[model samples]
Target: MSNVTTYKVTGMSCGHCEGAVSSELSEIEGVSAVQAAADTGLVTVTFTEEPDDEAVRAAVDEAGYELVGRA
Candidate 1:
C-alpha cells in the first residue's frame, strides 16, 4: 500500500523553490513522489511507508524552507 502525507512548508517563492523542495524530498529512501507548491506552501509526499519527521524537516531545511509539520 501507499501512504501520502502533506506538510505545511514556508519560504517558497517560485518554481525554483518548488524544485528545490521536491528534489530534497525525492532523494529520501522511501519517498516515491514529491509535489511542492510555491503558492500554497504545501509539500505532498508519497511513500510506501511512514517516513521520519526529522528526515522530512531536514530536507525542507536543506531546501532553504521550513517544515511546519503535517497539514
Candidate 2:
C-alpha cells in the first residue's frame, strides 16, 4: 500500500515555488507522487515505501524552502 503524508512548508509563494518544491520532493527514492500548494503551504507526498523524514527535509531545503513537519 502507498503511504500518504502531508507536510507544512514555508517560503512558497507562487507556481514557480510550487514547481520547485514538487520537483525536488518527487526525486526522493520512495516518493510516488507530490502535490505542493502554495496557497496553503502544504505538500502532500505519496510514498511506495517507508519515507525518510530527513530526506524529505533535505528536498525542501534544496528547493529553498523549510519543511515544518507534518501538517
**Candidate 1 wrongly placed segments (more than 4 Å):** none
Best-fitting candidate, scored by lDDT: 2
Model 1, backbone clash pairs (residues 3+ apart or across chains), number: 0
Q: Against the hidden reference, what TM-scores do the models get?
A: 0.96, 0.96
lDDT of 1 by residue, 15-55 (tens): 99999999999988899999999999999999987789999
Clashing pairs in 2: none
What stretches of model 2 exceed 4 Å from their correct place? Answer: none
The 10 consecutive residues of candidate 1 with the worst lDDT sum are 42-51
Candidate 2's displacement at residue 22, Å, is 0.5
lDDT of 2: 0.95
